[model samples]
Target: MKVQLLVSKWCPVCPQAERIWTEAAQKVPMDLEVLDVAERNGREVVSRLRIKTVPAVVVDGTLKTVGVQPLGEVLKLLGA
Candidate 1:
């Protein structure tokens, strides 16, 4: 599976979501990519993903969830 976690530094939920993603990613046997919305071209990447909010999880090119989902749920969303 290919998982992308999209977030911005200013987003309150981003950090927590990042932690959750990191943990889940360690368990899932696939590629994990994190896109910081504050990075250059970050906005464009988010827009291409059709994501309207930070702390968004895009799994295998599909929007799974946004904001802070429970770690277990986040893992499930990633198909782990």
Candidate 2:
């Protein structure tokens, strides 16, 4: 699965989002990409997805969650 974790530099929720995804990567079979919304590609992806918030998770090109989610929920989303 393709998982994109979209975050912003100034977003307070980003760090935990990063940590959760990073740890989850070890337990799931997925292509995880962490994007900083301050960058070009990140901005493009976020705009294309119509996501207005940070700490967003995109799984298989579909927006999954827009904020910090429990690890169990994330795993379920990943189909792990």
Best by TM-score: 2
Model 1, span 1-80: residue lDDT tens: 88888888788878898888888878877687888877866676787876788888777778878889887887676566
Residue range with the least summed lDDT across 10 consecutive positions in model 1: 38-47
What's the CA RMSD of model 1 in angstroms? 1.5
Task: Give the distance in Å from residue 62's predicted Cα in candidate 1 to where it truly belongs.
Answer: 1.4
Model 2 CA lDDT for position 19: 94
> In terms of lDDT, which candidate is strongest?
2
Stretches off by above 4 angstroms in model 2 are: none
Please report how far candidate 1 places residue 63 from its true position, in Å.
1.2
Task: Residues 1-80, candidate 2: write the lDDT tens digits.
Answer: 88999998899989998999998999998899999999998998898999999899988889988999888988887877
- For model 2, which pairs clash? none
Candidate 1 TM-score, C-alpha based: 0.85
Tell me the lDDT of candidate 1. 0.80
